[model samples]
Target chain A: MKLSIIGVGLIGGSIALKLKEKKIVDFVCGIDNSQDNLNEALALNIIDEKADLEDGIKNSDVIIIAIPVDATRKILPKVLDLMSDSQTVMDVGSTKAGIVESVKNHARRSRFVAFHPMWGTENNGPKSAIAESFSGKAGVICNREESAQDAIKMVETIVESLDMHTIFMNAEAHDLHTAYISHISHITSYALANTVLEKEKEEDTIFQLASSGFSSTVRLAKSHPEMWVPIFKQNKENVLDVLNEHISQLKKFKSALEKENFEYLGELIENANKIRGILDK
Target chain B: MKLSIIGVGLIGGSIALKLKEKKIVDFVCGIDNSQDNLNEALALNIIDEKADLEDGIKNSDVIIIAIPVDATRKILPKVLDLMSDSQTVMDVGSTKAGIVESVKNHARRSRFVAFHPMWGTENNGPKSAIAESFSGKAGVICNREESAQDAIKMVETIVESLDMHTIFMNAEAHDLHTAYISHISHITSYALANTVLEKEKEEDTIFQLASSGFSSTVRLAKSHPEMWVPIFKQNKENVLDVLNEHISQLKKFKSALEKENFEYLGELIENANKIRGILDK
Candidate 1:
């Protein structure tokens, strides 16, 4: 199958590479507004060719929107307008609700599949793409009933070929669960990084004394603002809910520490260790 | 040189393995309160032999205390009392201020070097020890002036042999830096894990939609409470201070989302990305 992936950055480039590695796509074309990104993607062989939106959508059997959520909302409908009944379109954005809402009543809505591959790293751009980025990860196909069966099956087959498990959820449930499990993680990491940067004046000391725990906890702080800002905006209510709870939890930790309540702190950590069961699954 | 490491668990067992791999110590002995840990260390060939603490101290030229901070504080005096001028003693615990204060005026204080290697995973015990655990990591040598120059040199040589860098800091400075960089990371992770567990009811969704970002952010929540509780108690003030700032930062993120201030949220993330510079250093 021929595929045209927009954005042509990390997730887009990675999908292109994986599809070609699995021999699932005959040709993978890409479109990016940034000339540098387009050049980098082509130079890295992440895309077989580059084309304009009109030509790309008209020619490819599949069109994948892999840009930031804000851009996805703006560009998704345009692609849907040109899509044929035989062509399938899917989005790999982190947030699903806003994008789905925008295209819900479109004439070609049946051709559009809303998806979120539950995988990413802090880095971005074409160079950040890796061969095993999505292997062993889960892919969420939101509001599957909204898409035609053929479009759903094609997207599922592609995700399955990448060795990823596929799960179906409505847009609301997907956004809520993501805010709890995924979006809050980035917020915590960013705030944790800012806290350290604020309190720890000696940058040299941080570089010298940083342990693996610190690195792991602050890893997501390196994520791109352009990518995450739209996500927080799109899933505002759920993200706000989790962020409030996270702050409350930190305040309790602070109070416990101030009171020297080692027993309480220990209990909190023990309870937190229950995440191991879910993670180990 | 003959070396004996007390507590033959993750940190101690891994040190033994690396020392043996590098052929730096002629004979390595291990002593642990848990028979299972000692047996695992022996089966893994992480040590050349196993012995009681008294026997190990009496026979070895160098001794390493690699237990929990509370255990280290309790056992350090006994180790110091048994040490001769020719023997060197060191510790690999997370907190340094309390341990340093405990042995401040000891007669053999000059013979003891307080060190903490900035490396570890969420797993613990002998079974969790890996051969390459400390390679390319930093080893903090706290209050080196309290240690005899020869002893400090010997410890530094061992750290260097393991392909790790040695950094110097006073005990108080070590505790404060660790609270900011290491201890706080664990607490934030534990609190984040707890927050998700409390808010999200769909356990299966969490397991399926969890991304690498979530895994990295929550990784330290899996750390053993037995290992971390004392560290938090020992560095109570610094941890509490950083924890307060962290909570405030999260609150700022929440308010930005609640107010639909995308500009502020974007700036917050962009500022947080400054951590990438320190991390890359």
Candidate 2:
């Protein structure tokens, strides 16, 4: 089998590496616009070969769009236009509703499947790819019925090769749940990073006093802006709804402190501790 | 050498385990208020024997007070009263200002060294203790001048045995810097957890869709309230100040989203990305 991957960054490079290792795909043709990324992916043996976008798509059995959500939205329709009826295409985009909507009325719409792999790190670029990163994570496929059975099965096979369990949800529901589960985390981490940067002038002190807890909370602050801005733009309303709730929740903590309500503060923490039940699940 | 640990929880149990492994302390006496914790510590080999507080202090060469900050503040003076002139005492309290002030006028003030080790996880209790957890972490000795030379040497030896480097700071600076770096992160984690729990009613969806980034950002929400409420109560002013700054920082991202300022949003994330420099240091 042959797979053509678009945008050879962390997610794309990782998928190619894993599929090749599992012998699911005999060849992986990396189709990235950046010459540096292509060179890095090739040198690291993350892909069997680097090919031009048009040639890569025409020769492969499947095509994976692993670019940023904004770029994916703009390029999905064009890719679908280029693919033959026998070929299958799937996107590993973070926001699904927009991508699914962009190719909704296309003649080749059924050839494409909307998929999101629930795994990531703060780092990016081809060099940051890890084959083991997605082993225990979720791979959500949205608007499953809109795609042809063959396309859905191909994506499911790819997800299984990556060692993730499959989840089915409509495009709208995927966006809503991701807003609460994923998008808001990046915003909080970025703000927490900026808070310490703005208020704490003694950089040496911060470097010395930082604990493991602080590092974990702000780890996502290092994520690329190019990737996140488009996600926030595409999922603006849902993200805003959650962000407002998050701010209000923080205010509850603030009010508790201001009133010197220790008991109330303890209650808030105890409520938060309930996350253990969900996280440990 | 012999050591007495007043509270056989995460920090104290960890300290005893490391000191014994390094052969710096041949015997350890546990003095936790809860019989369950003492039993668990003994079963896990965290402490050699359980002893009464007064008897334990008189027999040991050094004493470690590792309870909640509020409890430490109340018990510090009494512990100093029991110690002989040659014996030394140190605390692994999260907040230092209150603990230092509690024994300021005591006749044995110089025997108490105010210390805090910069390491922790969401889990607590002796069962969560890991001796290697302290390696490569910072151990801050606050108000070094207030401690006697012999007392300082004894605490410094303990830090070395834990395989951590020592950082010296005054009590006021430790509280202030920790508010910016450590204390505020917990509040944010607790708040983030509450935000998700309140808004995302579908527990299964959250369990299925949660990315590593969300889990990382909210990991500290699982910390026990018995430990945190006292830390907040002791360092209320500093925590409140940093919390206000953090809320304002989050508002910047909200305003950018509300105004549809993608350029400004990118700028905010790019600024947050600067944290990589400090974290990687």
Winning candidate number (lDDT): 2
Give fnat for candidate 1. 0.92
- DockQ for each candidate? 0.86, 0.91
What are the per-residue Cα lDDT tens digits for candidate 2 across B87-141? 9999998899999999999999999999999998888899989989999989999
Task: List all candidate RMSDs to the true structure.
Answer: 1.2, 0.7
Q: Against the correct fold, how does model 2 do in TM-score?
A: 0.99
Worst 10 residues of 1 chain B by lDDT: B41-50
Best by TM-score: 2
Off by over 4 Å in 1: none
After the best TM-score superposition of candidate 2, give how far the Cα of residue A94 lies from its true spot, in angstroms.
1.0
User: Model 2 segments beyond 4 Å from truth?
Assistant: none
Q: How many backbone clashes does candidate 1 have?
A: 0
TM-score to native of every candidate shown:
0.98, 0.99
